[model samples]
Target chain A: MSHPGADRVRDVARLAGRSARSKRRSFLAEGPQAVREALRRHRSGTPTVEQVFATDEALARHPELAEPTDGVTLRRVTADVLAAMSDTVTPQGVVAVCRMLDVGLDDVLAGSPRLIAVLCQVRDPGNAGTVLRAADSAGADAVILTHGSVDLYNPKAVRSTVGSLFHLPVVLGVPFADLAVRLREAGVAVLAADGHGDADLDALQDASAARRLAGSAPDDEGTGPRLEAPTAWLFGNEAHGLAEEELTAADARVRVPVYGAAESLNVGTAATVCLYASARAQRR
Target chain B: MSHPGADRVRDVARLAGRSARSKRRSFLAEGPQAVREALRRHRSGTPTVEQVFATDEALARHPELAEPTDGVTLRRVTADVLAAMSDTVTPQGVVAVCRMLDVGLDDVLAGSPRLIAVLCQVRDPGNAGTVLRAADSAGADAVILTHGSVDLYNPKAVRSTVGSLFHLPVVLGVPFADLAVRLREAGVAVLAADGHGDADLDALQDASAARRLAGSAPDDEGTGPRLEAPTAWLFGNEAHGLAEEELTAADARVRVPVYGAAESLNVGTAATVCLYASARAQRR
Candidate 1:
């Protein structure tokens, strides 16, 4: 489509937000990283892309973007069409419609599945994205988004992931009860990171050490049977942390202690700290 | 001052980026939190706020924002004026021109000055703001933004801070040479955090154990002069870490060990881990 008409453009713009995204059951992916990930997945015969739209200038800007791929058709559209489809400034000049990467619990738990981050009602797109990026970088098995979490495909959330979205399994819209039962059945230790956590993360480190001691021969620092069993570190919303029940359900409560007068750390920063703490301890 | 004309709006928008921010010696502070911080400081005899501009709707929406203050004056302008002035969606309906907080070395070291974060050339506004939030929460005495870092007052940077900008002194634009000399004079230990850091952060943690042990002897951390000291943790640009000279100038090099595919953590996340590690070690 060279250019959608005014009404169609309105529809495309609406697609950039939640309502249209839900209606279409697809979201727009823009930017070099996002588009490149989409194209690569399509070429690898994963999900066939619904549409590939690029401006002539985009094609010129990125000659490689014009490559041929089966089942993935490409078209040159007007800048207006590109603008209609974008929510970020400096659109990567290419856009694509992607069916959500909605993996099921079985698929998520099929692997060794050591580490996972379960985000609860994280409303900010930036925070949710950062958590996913942390999960991806930490080699977590997957990121499960429960009720009230921001939509992962929100353009801002996608931008914040910095392309890690493609590298990891991010399943959204899962409810708390379903996650609790699902992860429990898969032998995952669900831990919650809260300010009032029962134990500081230091204790978690100590617990990992104690587990190692119990599992291995006395001579080693004890590196056998990692204490975490397909772990899920649940982080709550920025303003209010995880609900009391969620905290109680955790195998343990972990906290990143603060020393300053500042009331609290940002949710994204805290989530990164907690994820890194667990990941580091597992390494030890 | 409703609708200061397209020319002025263009000028303000241009200044939101770096070159103009420097040339004009002013930066943008958008959203309720940042604007509220500016307003609070203005009321507290801080003399930093230069002007307050709000739309009629904003004034109506937030009447408490009109509390009379000595140093700052508030201006009620048309919706067009606030819309023209805002960089965020929905505007939070207020904008302020505040003098940058000019924190001198004397002011930074005025108190106990136990910990500090020195960021060099980190260009992302989100990263910079997150670091500020981390530093504030960790009870660090101050944050030093070396040359090439993002303008701390950029609207996005301010938003990321989530109001921590008001809690601590942030010194920006300081040359590296001056920072090194000043820190050395204050008997501070400068630690550089880089990908190639010589010692793992655990070593830094261990270094504090003796302080804590000796601290039990009374006279506050055993006259080792407040475990962390005038200690400054140096961080580098996102794309490029600390320069060879900057890293070498540090008293020690430390790294946060990672167990996953992430070659390195995000700069803000790394800085938070480092600062929090320092915070953990200094506690009683």
Candidate 2:
């Protein structure tokens, strides 16, 4: 059955994306686990969830949704309304909209971070999410998305993160020019992964033996050996790879060694390897 | 601009999936690279491609579609008709219905082989495709997908392979019961990846001593570092991972060591690491 405010529901759904354009709000907070995490970390110690739409089936499945809250708003919507609002194929039966958290560069880099991931022009939403999830697991401090990268709020991208989007701090919309300046200013060395590089990953790991790299760092760079500083890795687009301009801006160019048949690796897989390698180096 | 035979075109498009159920004739070929790869391989003596379809635009873009050959039926469809028949959001203007080639266990092991990948219950079409692509790049001799894995002819899976599916031999629908017997007969040992294993990946690689230990003969059944024969590396499902029964069946259970916070590597990333490690060992 159609609802009374079908147009309103559709409008809210569209608002998920256009919020950035229309209201200057660019992020979306979604999924049950994500919603819970968002609630747990509210500044007021009580998250003011702007809206809540739940189904009888969903509420029964997750009774926690029925819990009373002081500042949170509550409402009931048909499955169709929730479906219309959902970006994923199967809506997890819960979603929330809030102002995007503006995590400052200084705050994200407060300490001498051992690991950081810099994403350059990664176009696939799923790849972007997986990269973030990997970085979260590796205990990396932040993920930097440069120009031409897919938006992190793209629903498929958010779902792929499996709640990691909330756990970690992500900085997006930074141009390559700004990233080079900002990261360099923060003592972050940029290492871009290219297929043709002089140094092998194994030797590079040995070079950065003092730092305790964990979670994800930047992609490995340099001609001789491992990354030796507080590094930020640069990953490029799947098809075009790292642009020459971006590659030239990097402190080093590194590659994962391969043998025999394959010419290259998938962008996501390559990023994961480099991040994990840096983590291993730091641990040593 | 509706064509007279538009109904038939839509009917054919819908049948792509259902056709496999009845006729067991499923074909998923798209993009310029995929269609071109099919044409090149079929012309070079592989008898897989049964027919080719193109629009006038596609024919102009890829003149190779005009090549004459017996048993290769070339059909012309309108651009709209081609769009109706396409599975991708952006059709390459050319597609082909290729006969599925099931390279058998004996066929893949015909020569003294070095590297191979065996996927068990890997459900994601994209992950399966990447594994096949990685296998091809790593120069693996063959890729085998056990029952319960994603269908090899899935359109999403085919697209993710990026034409690498044509370069390497892939075998699907093999039951573990049959695979166990065939692997034993071929003098191949199976090593399954586990998250919580006794030793780390580096230790396992070091123990293999650069694959020099993977000599001509299989080790004694169920004893000491297990069989070092030409190996069959098994990858499990994305969520629950390898079942206890499946993990126990392997010649050895191995894990990729993690630092910091990642719960585990994404399924495709893990498969690539394990496959590349084995390939590296074989080379040594």
Candidate 3:
């Protein structure tokens, strides 16, 4: 192990921005959580990790981070080198450079996923990352970010996800129609999470429960699909909600009913609720 | 209406920092969402607003921004002055200076609350504000932040709340023990949202429904009060969860089961799921 040369440090720091990461075809995963997950994925034949830089203390603390195979490299550096390559105000002593992990819409669809999050034009990096984390927690098969959405590899977005990005398949740069048609053809009903939708989330949950209890499947009119059925949730941007064309493409537009004085929950929190609801219903 | 003097601009900008805000006894609520909510609260006589600064364009677009009552001043400023007074990179053409709105825990308890969110040592302004917005959306009567939590009036926290801060009572700086006792005296059952808790949220929801079907109140062994019962949800910090002592004080410690590869949802998203579960159960 040796201290990173000045040129190497400068090159790594360029990854703190989107353009460099895009051009290099790699991103930096900072801190222990993200680096740990990236290494895990890299070890599991993903080839996502390019190189890992850690201080002696950090390497001693997380020895598992040193485990890499087949072209993966680990280097020890002073704390200053780690900080220079990190985007956060405080560096966590470990940073992993990784190739992008996003797959194509076809790859995601080929899996016949049960639950997917289709984020359309979501601009906030933190929100996008939070939704990815929520989708992973809810056992979603994949997350598809339509065009105009925030860059999934943006440093802020990567950090916000903690490690969930490495835990799930994320599809980037897909068009709205491609996602809609592919999901529908896969028999995954697309539902729009609209604030002003006609369908109520609670009533849908109750109906699905009743159907399950009766030992039958949902065959109701105007209810679209039962909660237990394969589903794709379409979430829009933070400010202007789902476009009229986007909602029109959905099987049903459903709103998470607001019980209090708050106008509406933010996009990330709202998606979390919807994903959790679907997870609970499918389990039942 | 007139331009804000240079000194006034400097004073308002100082509110962006914690020490200055503490000294001035006021905070800046930047952007249209926050300013609108502050004005709404002011109009209702809660009188949280101190003064509002807006550009003529902003005023024309949102005529309601000019409707403050007696003793409230509306100043028209250049976009430059507005940006100077705002904490955001791009000022939204409006900013509201307001007194802190957090109330005493005793006041929140006196409201005979059915649902409440108790945040324990939660840091991260974005997470705190999202929890506030979630609690408000779930129709919680109030929110309580224990000692060691992030300041509720931190500019980042206020902006993340997206106007939900004015929708309900938020109690800050309460000791854990004091909050525990007051909630008990108010007949509210405290449930700790612990990741490793014994109780499962889905099972609890089903058991509550089962008890409802039995046509009797909650009296089951091991399962504490039904979720429909008046309750408070205790959430811990982002990195370290609730302390052992805090968990012991709760009636039941419940975990939101993770069905996917994600280890756990972030605290903010987890809180949203818990709050929505309670809101749905109460409605049923």
Q: Going through the candidates in order, what is chain B's TM-score?
A: 0.84, 0.85, 0.95
DockQ, all candidates in order = 0.36, 0.35, 0.76
C-alpha lDDT (0 to 100) for residue B65 of candidate 3:
86
For each model in turn, which proportion of the native inter-chain contacts is also found? 0.53, 0.44, 0.90
Question: What is residue B205's positional error in candidate 1, in angstroms?
Answer: 4.7
After superposition, candidate 3 runs with Cα above 4 Å error: A68-70, A217-223, B211-222
Identify the leading candidate in terms of TM-score: 3
Prediction-by-prediction clash tally: 0, 13, 0
Q: What does the lDDT come to for candidate 1?
A: 0.74
Judged by TM-score relative to the true structure, which candidate is superior, 1 or 3? 3
**What C-alpha lDDT does candidate 3 achieve relative to the native structure?**
0.87
Task: Please give, for residues A31-136, the per-residue lDDT of candidate 3 as tens digits.
Answer: 9999888888877788888888899998889888776567888899989878887888766789888998888888888888899998999999999999999999
TM-score on alpha carbons, each prediction: 0.76, 0.82, 0.95
lDDT tens digits, residues B1-284, model 1?
A: 54466676677666567677778877766655677777776676677666677777777777767777767767776766677777777667887776777587778866657789998988898888888889988889899998778878777887778778877888878888768768877767788888788777755454455445444542443322233555789989887888988987887778776555455677887888888777766654
Error of 2 at B183 (Å): 2.8
Candidate 2's displacement at residue A150, Å, is: 1.8
**lDDT, model 2, position A136:** 76
